[model samples]
Target chain A: MSKTILIVGGGLAGTIVANGICRQMGAELRSGALNITMLGTSETHMYQPGLLYIPFGRMREAELFRDQRKVLDKRVNFFVDPAKAIDVEKNQVTTEAGRTFKYDYMVLATGSRIMPQTIPGMKEGGHWFYDLDGARKLRTALNEFKGGKIVINVNAPHKCPVAPLEVAFMLHDYLKAKGLWDKAELTYTYPIGRLHALEPVAHWAKPEFEKLGIKYETFFNTESVDPQAKTIKSMEGSELPYDLLITIPPHQGAQVIDDSGLGKGGWVPTNTKTLHREGSANVFVVGDTTNIPISKAGSTAHFEADVTIDNLVSLCQENTFAREYDGKVFCFVETGLGSGTYVWFNYTTPPNPGPPSQMIHWFKLAYNRLYWLSARGLL
Target chain B: MAERQKIDARGAFCPGPLMELIAALKLASIGDEVDVWSSDKGSASDIPAWCAKVGHSVVEASEHDGYWSVVVRKAK
Candidate 1:
C-alpha cells in the first residue's frame, strides 16, 4: 500500500513540496505508489511582493494575484478549506468546515498572520499592507491623503523580511511623484538598531536613507498605537505623530498550530536543519511557522521546501536524514528614486553577513519573472 | 541618426542583464541601440526573447570570452 502524505497550507512552501512530491510520485505511480492531499482555505494565491507595489501605484492588486487552486498540479487532491486542528498522534487533520483526513506523513506550511486590527484603534485609523484586506484598506486611505508625517513602523519578525523597507521606499517614490515630497516627513522606525537584522545591510541601508532625506529611527520598539490621536508610542516613551500611519504588525504562526499543542505561542519549534517537529519524527515544518532564527520570506520558504522534501524522501526510504538546512535568506530592498538593493545572509547560529550589491536589486526584479516561470514548472 | 549606448552587463545573472537593458532603454534615443554583454548561460536566449515580445530590435548577439554581447535597438 502507498503511504499517504497530508500537507497543510497551500502557500509557497507547501506548493513547492506538493509539486516535487507529484514529480517523484509520477515515477513511483508508474510502478504504482503514493497518495497526497493538500488543504488551503482560499482559492486565490497572492503575489505578496505586489502588495508593496499596490500602495505605490506601480502594480494593481488584481494583476498581482492568481488562482491558487488552478496553480496547483492536479496530482494532489486540493481542498479549499482551512485546517483547524492536526491530531499529530493519530495523523489526522480537522478542517474548519468539519472534515477529517488521515495521513502517514504530514507537513505544515501554514503561513503567518499580521496582528493589525488586533491592536486598539488600528481599524479606525492605522493602515497596513500585510494581507489582501490590509492592502485594500491602505489603498482607500492613500487615495484621500494629502501630505504630512508618514510613519512606517515594524512590529518585528514579520514575513518577507525586506517588505517594511520596500513599502517605505515605494512610499517615498509615490509622494515625490505626487509633488508632495517636501510637504511630507517620512520616518521609518524599527525596533532593531539597523534597518534589517543583517548588520551589513543596515550599514548600507542607513546611508541610502541619508541620501533620500528620509529619517531612520532605530531601537524604538513599538508598544502600541493611539490612532485616535494619530500618535505612535514606543516602549521607550518616544512618540511620533503621523498623518498616515503605515504599520507592520507583529506576526505569529497559524492559530491552529497552537491549538494542536504542536506550537508554543505562534511558532512551531523544530530542528532548523532537519525541519523535524520537536519530538515527532513523521511531521515536518516549512516556511514562516518554524521557529528558525531567519527571515521568514518566500525565498526561505522555497529553500526550506527543498530541504523538507529531501528529508521526507529519506525517511520514507528508511535512509538516514543527511541533508541539513542552512538557513539561507535572500531579500530585495527597494530604494526609491528608481533603484533597489539585494541582501542575503547565510545563517549559522551567528549568521555570516553577505555584502549588499546593486545586482541584488536586479536579481529581485528578475525574480518576479523567474518565480512565475518556476511556478509553472518551466524553470 | 546617432551612435547607440553600450552596456557591459557581462558576467551578470538572469534578470540582471535584462533589467540593466530595460533601464538603459529608458535613457536611449528612439533609434539608438543599447548593447548588453552577459556571460550568464540564460541571457543569450532571454535577451532575444524579450526583444521579440516587447517589439524591440536585436541588432547583433555573439559569444565572447565566457559571455555574449547582445545589442538591442529601441524601436519605439
Candidate 2:
C-alpha cells in the first residue's frame, strides 16, 4: 500500500525535504508507493537572511520574496493553511480551516517567530531589523538619526545569532560614510557575558569590535525599556540611555505545536541526533521549531532536512531509521565594507571562524540566489 | 575566429553575473561563445559549476586586475 507523507510548514526545511524525496524516490512516487503533501501558512517564502541588508539600503525588499509554489517541486502537493493540532496517537493533523489529514508519516518544519511584546516597553519603544516592516521602519529612523547614542540590544535567543554583530559592523561603516561616527556613541549590549554564544567566534570578533570603537556590554539582560525617557534598564538595575534602540526580541515556537501538546516552553522537543520527536515513532521534526541548542538558522534547517529525508527514506525501505544529524551549522557574517566572515561548526568541533574577506561576501551573495535553485533541487 | 560576446557583470553581486550569463546564452546561437567579467569572487567557481551542470563548455577562465573573466560556449 502507498504511504501518505504530510509535511507541515513549506518553508526552506519542508520544501527542501520534499524536493530531496522527489529526486531520490521518483520511481517509487510515480509507481504509487508514496504520496506527499505540504502545508504552509502562505505562498510567499521570504529569503530571511536578506533582511540583514535592508537597513543598509543594500538590498531591496521585493528581492527577498518569492512565490513558494514556483520554488517547490511539482511532484508534491502544496496547500495554504495553518496547522491547528497534531493527533499523534491517531496519526492525523488538523488544520485551522476544519480540515484534517491522515498520514503514515509527518514532518514538522514550522519555524519560530519573534515575540517583541514579551519585553516590557519593547513593542512601543524599540526597533528591530529582523522583519521586513521592522527593517523599513529602521531605515527611516536611521536616515533621520543625526548622531548621539545608538544601541543594538539583544533581548533573547534570537534567530541568526550573528545578525546583531553584523548590524553593529554595518552601522559603524554607515555612520562613518555619513560623517556621523564622531558624534555617535555606538554600543552593543547582550544578555550573555560573551560577545557570541560560541567562544571561538568571540575570540575572532574581539579585535574587530575594538577596532571599530564599538562598546561591548555583556550581561545587560534587559528588564524593561523606558521609551519616552530613551533608556533601557537591565535586570540588575543598570540603565543605559540611547538615542535609537534596535533590539532583537525573544522567540517562540508555533502556537499549534504547543496546542497539540507536542511541545513545551513553546518549542518542540526532539532527539537532537535522530530528528524524531520524543515518544513518537512516525513523526519527525526539524528547523527552529525543535528545542536544539544550535543556532536557529536556515543553514541548520538545510542540514537537518538532509538527515530527516535520509531517515524517512530508510524507514520506508528497511522499517527503521539510521541517519543521524551531527548538529552541523554554517553561517556567513557580513562585517560591512563589502566583506564578511564564515563560520563552520558541529556538535563535536568548536566553530572555526575564517577571517573577514570580500570573497566570502560574494559567496553569501551567491548562496542567496542558489537557495531558490536549492529549493527545487536544481542546485 | 569564432564570434565571442562579452558580458560586463563587474561590480554585480553573485548570481547577478551568472543570471546575466544565462540570459545572454538564451539569445546566442549554438557554438557562439560568451565571455563574462565579474568582480564577485564566487563567479570564478560558480560560473564553471553552472556550465558543467547544464552541459555548456568553458573555454577559458582568467584572473585580471581585481576581477575574473570566464568564457563559455553553447554546447547543446
Candidate 3:
C-alpha cells in the first residue's frame, strides 16, 4: 500500500507544495510507492500580490482568480474543504464538515487571514485590498472616489510587505494621470520607519514619494478606526482623517494552525534552516503562517518549498535530513510609471543584506507569467 | 576629445542592462556615449529595442566571446 501524504492550504505556498509533492511523488506512485492528498477550502485560487495593482486599475478582478482544479494533476485526491482541526499526535486532519483524514506525512501550507473586524469600525468604514474580495471592494471604491485625502493604512505584519508602498505610488500615478494630483492628497501610514524593510532600499522610496507629493506618516502604528468620525487613531495616540481609507489588514495564521495545539503565539514556529514545525517531527510548514524572521512573501514560500520538499522526501525515505535551506527572498517593488525596484536577501548570515536594482520590475512581471504557467502544470 | 562610459552588465538580467544604461545616461552629457556589456541572452535585442523606443542613438552593437557590447549615445 502507498503511504499517504496530506497537505493543507491552497494559497501561493500551499499550491507550490501541492505541485512539488505531486511532481516528486508521481515518480514514486508510478512505481507503486506513494499516495498523496492535497486539501484546500477554495476550488478557485487567487494571485495575491496582484491585489496591490488592483486599485490602480492595472489588473482586473477576473485576471486574479483561477479554478484550483484546473492547475493540479488528476492523480492526487483533492479536498475542497477547510481544515478545522489537526491531530499531529495521531497524524490526522479534520475538515470543517467533520471529515477526518489520516496521513503518514502532513504539510501545513495554510497561508494567513486579514483581520479587519479586529479593529473598531474597520470592517464597515475602511477598505482593504489584501484578498480577492477586499481587492474587488477597493477597486469599486477607487473607481468612484474623486479628489480627496486618500489614506493607505498599514497594520502590523501584513503579507507582501511592499504592497502598501506600491499602492501609494500607483495611486499617486493614477491621480496624476487623471489631472487630480492637486485635488487629491495621498498619505501613507505605516508602523515601521521608511517605506521598505531594508534601510538602503527605503532610502530610494522616500524621494519617490516626495517627488509625487504623497504625504507619509511614520511610526503610525494604528490602534483603531472610527468610521462614523472618519478617523484612524494611532497606537501612540494620534488621529488622522481620510476621505478614503485603504488598509492592508492585520494578518494571523489559519484557524487550524492556531487550534492544532502545535503553533506557538498563534503561528507555527520553525527552525530557520529547516521548516520543521517546532515540537513536531512529522509535520512541516511553509509560507506566511510560519513565524520566520523574514519578509513573508511568495518568493520566501518558493524558497521554503525547496527545503520542505527535500526534507519531506528524505523523511519519507528514512534518509538523513541533510539539507539546510538558507532563507533567501527576492521581489520587485512597483514604483509607478512602468518603473520598479528589485530587492533580494539571503538571511544566512547576521544582518541579512538586501541588494536592490531596477531590473527587478521586469523580473517580477516575467515571474508572474512563470507562476501562472507553473501552477497550470505547463512548465 | 570625447568622453566615453563603459558599463559591464554581462552578469545581470533583462531590464538590468537597460536600467544601467538609463542611469548612466542621466549622469552623462548629450554627446557622451556608453558601452554596455551584457551576458543576458535577451540583452542583445532588448537594448536595441529600448534605444529605438526612447530615441537614443545606437553607435554599435556586436557580440563578443560570451557577451554582447552595445554602445548607446544620449540623443536628448
Residue A181 error, candidate 3, Å = 0.8
Residue-level lDDT of model 1, residues A198-246, one tens digit each, is 5555676788788888897875556568877899887545889988998
Question: Model 2, stretches more than 4 Å misplaced?
Answer: B1-76
Residue runs of model 1 more than 4 Å from their true location after superposition: A30-32, A349-363, A376-379, B1-76
Candidate 3 CAPRI assessment class: incorrect
Each model's total of backbone clashes = 1, 0, 0
What DockQ, between 0 and 1, does each candidate earn? 0.01, 0.01, 0.01
Model 3: per-residue Cα lDDT over A48-154, one tens digit each: 77777776777777877788887776666788988888998889998988999998878888887887876778888889888777777888887887778888997
Q: What is the TM-score of chain A alone in each candidate?
A: 0.93, 0.97, 0.93
Which stretches of candidate 3 lie above 4 Å from their native place?
A349-360, A376-379, B1-76
Cα error, candidate 2, residue A143 (Å): 1.6
TM-score of each: 0.78, 0.82, 0.79
In order, the interface RMSDs are 18.7, 21.7, 17.2
Fnat (0 to 1) per candidate: 0.00, 0.00, 0.00
